[model samples]
Target: MRAHRIALWLAVGQLACSPGRARTSSSPEPAAPVVVPAPTRETPRAIEPPPTVTVVSPPAAVEPTTPQVDATLIEGPAAPAPASPAQHARLLDSPEDPEPKLRGGIVKELEDVSYIVGNEWSLDAFREVITGLGGGYVGVGPDQAYLMMGWQRPEFAWLIDYDPKVMRVHAMYHALLRHCGSRKEFLAAFEPEATDAIAEVLDDAVADDRVRRLYRNNRDMFRWRLRSIERKLARRRVPSWLTDDETYVFVRELVLGGRVRALRVNLLDDLGMVGIGDAARELGVVVRVVYVSNAEEYWEQYAPQFERNLAALPSDARSLLLRTRLVWQVNRDYVYNAQPLQDFLAWLAAPGVETLEDVVGPKPPAQRDRINFVLTTARPP
Candidate 1:
């Protein structure tokens, strides 16, 4: 019994002497250590501070890296819109005239082009005479009217033609000028290969189906017309809207402002010219320049309606009538003449003055083979 008691005492001593089981009765127990997770390879060291041994939350789930892209580059460029007539109205003092109806002629096919690009090679000569006469302009034909308008800088311009096709031509001009960014862009829109592209632009921009159809059907003719004008102007060394960027911008702004209108007007018609005159008078705008373009030669006698049409137009002392006649005596295609508006009216009023021949009595003796301007005197007081 004594040996067993001694063995139990040795066992108790061994247990109490164990290093991990050692304890002091007067000391308190030590606290447990906090657990902190180590950062992964995915964690961005520059953006986050290093994790400490202290208690903390796990890092938020890392978002996948994405490539940034511009929205415009993804969607591509947007197409342009048509010119706003509302914007145009804000620039004008008077309201627009009511839309005029077709009065005289309708051309059916491209082959029927009487004056797509006129043969007035000498129109540049009139620039000096017409410049600075900036009221309202009434003219016939297409490019020549624009050339004269560019020179004169009219406040408002009426492109009146007997043929409806000419108005269609003007609509094409409106579309091209309104949408094209620069002179190069303008010329390129008229290229033969650009037919479908320009048709698309016109389709988007022009509201008139007739205008679009005319352009699509007669692409070759219109292209040829523009190219011919470019070549002609280049050959003549004339600084025109097509050839000059500044002039093109000037004319383009005018078209964009809605100051230009195309109408089907016949000089001898009872209603069309009379309506135009009434519109001008209502607007309080004078017709400073009237370009008849050989239409006077068509009549042998002064039709009373034609006389009334001329008389009806509001004019000032500076107002003039521009006409062209093929004087074979002068070696050019036409002799350009400017007659004072009042004098032309007086000649039409005179009983003996029957024809255009009586008004422009004779060709100049000295002028030959060159563009010449014949300035008619004012009516005798």
Candidate 2:
């Protein structure tokens, strides 16, 4: 029995000491790392590298086409309203006033009447006649006459004298009577209180050169009769040489009224007569002639033919015919236009025209021709 016990103990000890048996507790061994082959055409397999991770970045973003909606999205404030129709209607309804009419026939008659003359009278004689008749004359040439007049006065004058040639004065008087309304109306308007005034002036007339000439010409007889009528009207002793013609009274009235200035013919129209030596004798007024050579040469050739027909005119009548020479020159030169002359003449006829510096100022030589051209073209009948 003792032998058996000892063998058993030895077996147990041998089992515990066995080489494949665990003697103490321990964790199981990890499995061996698996080996994978690279992918091949036939036996494709994925090979992973030793835990090496790779990071990939994404692409950049793009913007949208439509605008983004706002957080509030309510409609904006409304626009202001337009103006009303009543305001526009009120602006268009206002009215305008009428203008006054001008005195026409009188102005027309004054423009139409012109003086004419023949060659027999000296310029001085012609001027005296004009002055006596209460008109102003400016001699433009040896044969020419320039007469000017204004409203309310005899701006121009002519005397009725017997002339075998031209008979212009007779024609003028008849034309004036026909065209300027009745002689009675003209006489009354122009020579108010004529008889009384005539008698007074004749009584005061002395034996001066003017008085002597008046007597020698039978003007004294005419004046005596005129003064007798005036004295009877005035109940006073009247002088002779005062009453000559009713026209004389008409003229005297103009002079006394300061409507006329008795200028010498040689002083106002003849440019040749206007130098320092003779100018002082010409009185304060001066005259100038503007000859347009271009037209004058042409007219000179034809003027003689017309002169025979014109020769029978009185000296005053002939003077008027000569003044028309400028008109002919302008017509021949083709520089004539009627409107500007009419406008200028109209301006001249306006009240106080004498005081306008621009109208009466000294003109340049170049401009004088232009003025002549305009005047010749524009003068009324």
Best by lDDT: 1
TM-scores for every predicted model: 0.67, 0.20
- Per-residue lDDT of candidate 1, residues 224-270 (tens digit): 54666666665655556666666676677777767777776667777
Q: What CA root-mean-square deviation does each model show from the true structure? A: 40.4, 60.8
Query: Lowest lDDT 10-mer window, candidate 2?
Result: 14-23
Q: Write the per-residue lDDT of candidate 2 for residues 190-259, one digit (tens) a residue.
A: 2434434432343344322232222222222222223333343222211111212333334333333332
Cα lDDT of candidate 2 equals 0.22
Off by over 4 Å in 1: 1-114, 235-237, 327-332, 363-368, 378-381
Mark the regions of model 2 whose C-alpha exceeds 4 Å error after superposition: 1-203, 206-210, 220-252, 263-381
lDDT of each: 0.58, 0.22
* Best TM-score among the predictions, by candidate number: 1
